[model samples]
Target: MGRRAALFILFAATALAVMAALSRPGVPQDRALAPGPRGTGPIIVAVLGTSLTKRASWPDRFAGGLSECLGREVQVTRVARANANSRWGLAEAERVAASRPDLVLIEFALADADLTDGVWPGESRSNHRAIIEAIRERRPDVRIVLMTTNPVGGLHRLKRAFLGPYYRVYRDLADELGAGLLDAWPRWPGTASIPDGVHPAPEAEAQIVVSPLLTLVAPGFGAVCG
Candidate 1:
């Protein structure tokens, strides 16, 4: 073959290979898959945490998103209290367990500092461990996913002092509990994504929180584009 012709053929082969790679199964498609059935009975999803989870309106948004994605009926119940610690979260989880939720989204690490009343680090860790144990005991079959709260926007001090540790503890706990982790820390790209710095704006509904949780709950469900 001529030099130019040989080069052209090689380029064409490379392009074909690239296209094949892009077309592989499991590769996320441009179009989102149609949602499944909404559960007949209550598909309870309890979101336990501090004010951020309650005030951010994540539970409502998550229920809507999950329902749309799974095509199943989902009733998300929020058992959250402002500034409550892991201890409080476990108590709420007990109440939620009685309801027999299909899934639980745990968001208690942010309020761990609230329990730090002159206690040693070891004591705090023990308390957290006890809480996780209780949750597992109550809901052995229930799927539990840990949600690490995002850093407070423009508040470097609070982020460093409170959110940083909170994120670490949740990360560790998720691993220990063999639970899924939705670390929202890196998900918030910029201030524009969060209207009030702490709470995500309605526009960020699809990306920051919903998308991650969807992936964890239903990995092979379908594509989710903003």
Candidate 2:
């Protein structure tokens, strides 16, 4: 084959692979695959995220549900910052490590923003990795639970255009790092009762975030008040 033709073919294959690698139309059952500590006693869970972490009552909900399931104490410490990206999480890594949480649940809301040039996913990945490494250095036994952002309805064109790339990064990184994942967007109820499209409705929070967290936190422990 001619050299130009061969190069064209190779470029086409690479492009196709990149497209396939970056697309995540839906989530797989990866949350169940992540490793964590399912010990039989009291535990501390620290939630670090964007506004989603701040707005949702999932931490308290998880505590309540988990306590009921295990018949032991469950404490949730939230270290969330509104409008924050992964960089802030990286900066807060030391403090989070100091908190001595048994598990750190991380969710970065602005990682998918259309405004962050083309490097949002890459930046997010680096920040997340740095934070994870820092925390691990301080607390080798701590487990991390990485969660995907909740859905903004399809009508929200800005997010719909760019969000999947961020999701791709989170999903791939979770697998690569062997960290726990919670792909909460797919199961999220649409923006019905919520005031805005970004934050999930309360029912959606209970269904997607709270329930999955309860399952992960307690491991073998079963259902609780939702």
Candidate 3:
């Protein structure tokens, strides 16, 4: 790519992040992580997240999608808890880094987790950055991918509005470090199959979460609709 193209992409990505922060939401905040040299060797994909990553969740589905795209064996390890909070992530930071992942996806949905407390994300942002620093310490070459999640429903549009800013933490981090991102919130393709609206249903996972992740890691690599 030419210098002009690279700078143009950066500007576009930053603009997209600003737009998502200002308007839509799901996909990571920044588009700064333009595709780079892909890993040709076997890969270890680690996910540090909350409920969205647990009990055979997005991490699991993305593993399958990435495998087909890479045309090689891939291992996915999840460090997730059900509350969709970042507390457990802080506790297990070492374990996450020990996994030595070539790629890492991180999200906590902190703002939407406890709307009763309001949309304060100061702690949420710092803790996640600490986790990223920890992982990066061990593997400097690792590609960290920030992914905003599905739109919430129980609270309806309100929950999404509250949660959108929190997702920006990941986007800003990605931009600062020049990492990868999925930006699932605004980009998610379908309806909330769940009654609560916060968690995406299984079917929604395949289309919104899994397929897009596949497309990100490996373009043209089709994801199976689970």
Best by lDDT: 2
TM-score of 2: 0.78
Q: Per-residue alpha-carbon lDDT of model 1 for 1-226, expressed as tens digits? A: 8999999999999966664443222211111123333334446788777677777666777778877766668898778777666666655656877777777777665456433422333544566566556666877666677776554455532333444544566566666666667776655555666555655665464456776677666532333422
C-alpha lDDT of residue 127 in model 2: 79
Give per-model TM-scores.
0.67, 0.78, 0.73
Full-model lDDT for every candidate: 0.60, 0.70, 0.67
lDDT of 3 by residue, 44-156 (tens): 88888777677446676677767766666789888887765665676787898888887788877643346564335787777777777888888887777777776665445
**Top TM-score prediction, candidate number:** 2
Comparing candidate 1 with candidate 2, which one achieves the higher lDDT? 2
Clashes by residue pair, model 1 = 36-70, 36-71, 37-71, 37-72, 38-71, 38-72, 38-73, 39-72, 39-73
lDDT of 1 at 192: 68
Question: Cα lDDT for residue 187, model 2?
Answer: 61
Model 1 segments beyond 4 Å from truth?
Answer: 1-41, 114-125, 154-162, 190-206, 219-226
Off by over 4 Å in 3: 1-41, 110-113, 116-119, 156-161, 189-191, 219-226
- How many clashes in each candidate? 9, 0, 10
Model 2 Cα RMSD, 1 decimal = 6.1
